[model samples]
Each structure stands twice: as C-alpha cells, then as structure tokens.
Target: MTREESDMIDHRRLGRELDLFVSDPLAGAGLPIWLPAGAAARHAVEEYVRDLERRAGYQHVYSPPLGKRELFALSGHLGYFADDMFPPLRLSADDEFVLRPALCPHQLVYRARGRSYRELPLRIAELGGMYRAERSGVLGGLSRVRAISLNDAHNFCALDQVGEEVREILRLIREAHAALGVRPAGFRLSLRGPGEKYVGDDAQWARAEELLRAALDGVDFTEAPGEAAFYGPKIDIQIVDAAGRESTLSTVQLDFDKPERFDLSYTDASGARRRPVMVHRSLVGSMERLFAYLIEVHQGAFPPWYAPVQLVLLPVDAGQAGAAAELARRAVAAGLRAEVDAGGSLGARIRDAAHRRVPYVGVVGAREAADGSVSLRLRDGRSVAPMPVADALGLVGAVVAARSTDLLPAAA
Candidate 1:
C-alpha cells in the first residue's frame, strides 16, 4: 500500500490485526463474524448500554429478528422500506415472514397494549437484531453490514411531553457518546424534501420538524432535506472517519404516524383515550457500525473498560510464573479481562501484549513477585512503579467503574 493508503485508519485492517472480526465469502458480503476478542468488547459495551437505558427508566424487551409480512406492512416498512429488506421466508402458502428491517413495528405493538396516563411516557428499549439487503458494493467490514443489532428505543408519550422527552433523549445521546469515546463530526436535522415518499402528511411533518428544531435550540446543526425517515424528521449524529467519509451513528426521530397506523392510545384523565406520539431513538445505532467507528477511532486501542484484554501478566522467569498466575486469577475474579503470558521471553511477551493493544501489561519479577507487587507498563508507553497486585487491580477497577477514558490513575 502507498503511504497515504497505509496511513488511512481503516477498521477492516485493524480488525484483522487485532483478531477482532472476519468476513468470509460463505458468510456473504456485509456479514462479518465477530471473533472472540471482538465479541468480548461488544458484550462489555452492550452491558453498559443496557444498564444506561435501565437507569434512564427504559423498559427493555426482546423480539425475534423476523416478523410476519403484515407487521411491516402495517408499519409502512413493506410499502416504503422493502427495497432495503431481505426477501420474505415462505413457510407455507399463507405464512410469510420477512427479516425485519426495523424494530419500531414490534416496539409500537408494545405500547399499543393498554396504557394509562401515568404511563404516558412509556420508554421501551431493545438491543435487537434485524437484517438489511445491502448491495455488495456498499458492503465493507462491520461499518456497513447486512445483519444489524440495533440499540433502538421508542418513547410513547402524550403530545405535551414531546419537547422534554426529546431534550432528555438528546442528553442521553450525549452521555452515551461521551462514554463510548465517539466524537461526532456533526449534527443534522433531517427533514422531508419536496415530492418525497413519506407516511405522514405535511402538517404532521411540519409539526415534527418544529419539535426537533426546538429541541436543537442551543445546538448548532445543519438541516438536510430529503434525509428524514419515511415517518418523521430526525436529529442524526454523524461521525467522520479517517478517510473523511461521514455516516450516521445515532439518531432521535419523532414519529406521530406510527401511533395512528398502530392505533396506539392511552387512557387519559376523565376516561378519555388519546393518541400517543412515538419518539424513536438510538443512543448508538448498531453494534456493527458502532464498533466500526470505535475500532477506527481508537485504532484498536480501546479504552480499558471495553478493551478486549484489559490486562496481561508477564512473568520474568519460571520463578515468577506462580505469582503471575495468582495475579491473573485475582484480576479475573475482580471481573477484569486478564491473562498470564509466560511461554516466551519477558521482553517478547511484553512486546506481544503491546502488539495486541493490551491496556495494562503487568511485569512480575523475582523481587516484585516476592513482595506481592507488580510493575505495570501502560499501552501508552508509561511504566508504573512496582505496586501491590491488589492496588493495581483496584486502580484498574476504578477506571473501569468510572468509565473514564484515561488509562492511568487520576493521581498518576
């Protein structure tokens, strides 16, 4: 590769070097398999996101990847989004299931089941799987994939609660982005363009756009016409890669149409049934796309909390191997991803840890091991003074707990 090409921060290349993911012809284009290391990081991130949603009062739910053909049809996906969806699976003459292209259809049904004014702002979330019929040309690594696991949520709320709910969603998005080390390239207010195929009428679209605009009152964003979802306008969080290509990583969309199509309603005060507006949101869009951005941005050196291997212990010789093993066990027991590397020379093992982008490389030698202390070599190339293994574990644990981007302790 030429210098410029070599310098490009491509996740595909990094992913291979780090053994994060792989794609095979048999698996088909745009479908990348997450290797163990990749899966571990993804699992950590997914856990964090789920807890975040739970703390934010979101009720999590699970749904099958595919749904009946009529489900998407009623949600307008079959009518407007079928082109991007896989062909239906025909189980029989009358039974056809399409790999769902979106999760809102099933999510809308969740709110449609009797709700009350007290549940006016019912927030439902799912890290659910869906499929996309992406063309081969646009398919590459995890960034653009056919199979998607989306961090999707929908808030069913009365009309008056729309503004506050939207603002709070934006706040949650910001918090998630900060924790994930995502640097948004820009914010976009995607609106409906003239003559475009859309589900809702002009007045509804106008009102939705106005609500988004008000929510973005203090934020600077560019308006992109013809970029809105078929149902409503959205605020798309964009990210630019090393190659300067932009893609949407997260979004908060306001939908007043789905409630109408799904006939979603809630009992208000005085026994009145009123329609609820759907606020569709995603803190991080999809696991595939999120990891794609994360891999490229961090250059395989993920933050310690979600790093594939948070710590690797390297013993100086066989004499220190026992100490290393003990430390490894303790680290793992404390819920840190750690291991011992004692097969090769200490220098070689250290280099391999660096190559693998391990956040912490613990070096246990005779004296240090005897004292129950270890020296740490950080991924960023700093060496820490020999410290007790317990202290080291506690330091790492604190970093993980705070979700801080810094690898070194605050005092350090």
Candidate 2:
C-alpha cells in the first residue's frame, strides 16, 4: 500500500490526530480511555441505537458486568469458553466471581423467571460493558480491547417463532448499519462441524441450523463450517472497510442450548411449559470497534450527526468574537454541537478544524455579523457564502436530525 493509504487506515494515528481516545501504560494494555470527543461520538451512537431498538419493540435493561462463577457454568461457558474468559475472582472458599465475557448468560438469567406465551419474542437490549481476557499481544486500538461496550440484545421466542425472530434481527442489523453508512459485504452462515466443543445434541443443532437457513432463504450467504459459536449457529455480517480490510461487525445468532441449560420456560397457549429459543443479536458489535471502523472507512471525516464537533465557529478577527460566541450559543440551543475557535489566526483555525474533520466551518467577520449571517465552508470544499443565521440553523438542524451522511444537500 502507498504511504498515504496506509496512514489513512492506521486508526491509532488517526485517533491521536482526532483526540478521540487514549491508551496509557498506567491503565494497562488493551484498555482505552475515551476522551471528551470520543465520548460524545460514542454517546451519539448509543442514543441512535437505543432509539432504533425502542422503535423495534426492544426493552432496554442494565445488567451487572460481573457474574458469579456458577452462572457461567450453568450457561456452559465454563466448559466451552473458559480460555477466553478472565480468571475467576475468589471472594471466599465457596464464593467466586468473574467479569462477564459475554452478556448472554445474564440475559438468560433474566428470562428464567415465569413468562407467558404472550411475552414470547421478548426482546431485551443493553449497551452492556463486558470484559474478556484478551491476550496482550493481540490487542490493538479500539478494534480489539479487554473491555468492550457491547450493543447486545437477546430475544426469547417460542420454537415456531424462531425463524421470524431471526429475520427481524437480521433486518435490524441491516437498518442500523445503513444508518451509520456502513454496508455489509455479505453474510456468513456459521455452523458447527464435527466437534465435541459444540454444546447441544446433533438433533437440536440440526433443527437450529435448518431454521437459520430457512430464515436466510432469499438472502445471499456463505456457509462457514466450524465458525459457529460453541452454543449455536449464527449469521456473521462481514463488512469490508475502505482500506479493503474485512471484519465482522454485526451478528444474529440462534442459540437453543442456553435456554435449555438455564431451564428457562414459558407457558404456551395450551398451558404447557416449553423452553424458549434465545436469539443473540449485536447491531454494531462494540462501540469501540465501530468507532475504529468508521474512522478508517471515512478517513476521520465523520458525518455531521456523528461528528464530535459538528460545526466550528471561527471569528475572522478578535472583534468578531462576540458574534461567534453568540452564534455558537444559538447552534447549541438548536441541539447542534458547536464550538468557537477565536484564539488562533483565522486561516490557522480553519485549517485545524478541517484537519480534525469537522463537518462544517463557519467564518464570522464584521460583514457576516452585520449581515446577520456566516460564511459556511463544508468538508467537501463547497462554500456557501452569506448564509443567514436562521437558514444555517435550519440546514444543520435538519441534517443532524435526519442523521444524513452527506454534508450538503444534493442541489448544493
């Protein structure tokens, strides 16, 4: 690869340049601290995902990051995934806890309570924080981390409802990715092969695999044997970034063994007790990984809605500082992220903001102040001169509200 191309894909360097996040030796390897800008972007993503989940009938819940050792044992992680998990912490001779490596076990516990047939297809969502024992050698920037903020959810549905639930989960994944301007290259139908590592019996596995395949009937996918999770078959959505590197960003897994292991049941229409099938879904697997993907894909030019600093107000001179400050306040009041850069030279400030990939740069000068407007410069090199304050607010507010990836309208 050329030097510029390689540099664009190096998220570590981009993260530093954008001041998105930081990693320190004091905090240990594989753990990243999100600075203010990164945190703002993450919060925006979380809010957007939550809104999507809400519209899809998902009920959000908060689960603890750590669980008792026995909890994972009951979920079969002790047998199948012990190496990937952090070592258990011993509280007492009989009491031990471990940080959760996945949110599925706790979600299973949540559905273990009495449930009725009407509640079948119950979707529970969380922006769960999980910890895994990732090897230090394999740790990278945000792409791979010990602590992960997962956009995870689980759907408990009846046997006959599994296909429809999986389809809905897949739809959710596509919609969410599209909103973020990320496109899935294809889907992988990951299934277990001949192995003792898989949890369920052959019959159960066959049924689950069949149902998953049926759900992807018209959709294109490749069968990847041995790539399935120990507990279930899954659809791994692969995305190729602009740099031509591929990664799995979203997944819809059909888990049948966990509910049975946990003895989770719901009363059926005939008043018969039946185990509910669990569907594990992650739209943007983890916020950190998604952020890294976006940084590389867009080359740090985040869309206006997702940009940490959507707009930067630059005063042409010190005399225009008051006008710039007032405009910043107005933008903030309109629910836009704006900041005033009145310190450096006007040209230097504009260049700095552009380098940081701010979506819109507003230059405020005496003429602009007197005209009650600002000269807007877009990231795409399009300049809209003398835009009225009200018009600018309306334009930006609409883009932010609509979550448009394009900075300017088509007509522009």
List of clashing residue pairs for candidate 1: none
For 323-363, candidate 2 gives per-residue lDDT tens digits of: 99999999999889999998878889988998989999999
Q: Which regions in candidate 1 have their CA more than 4 angstroms from the true location?
A: 1-8, 108-112
Each model's TM-score? 0.98, 0.97
Q: What global local distance difference test value does model 1 have?
A: 0.91
Model 1, range 269-306, lDDT digits (tens) per residue? 98898998999999999999999999988988899999
lDDT of each: 0.91, 0.88
Cα TM-score of candidate 1: 0.98
Q: In lDDT terms, which candidate is top?
A: 1
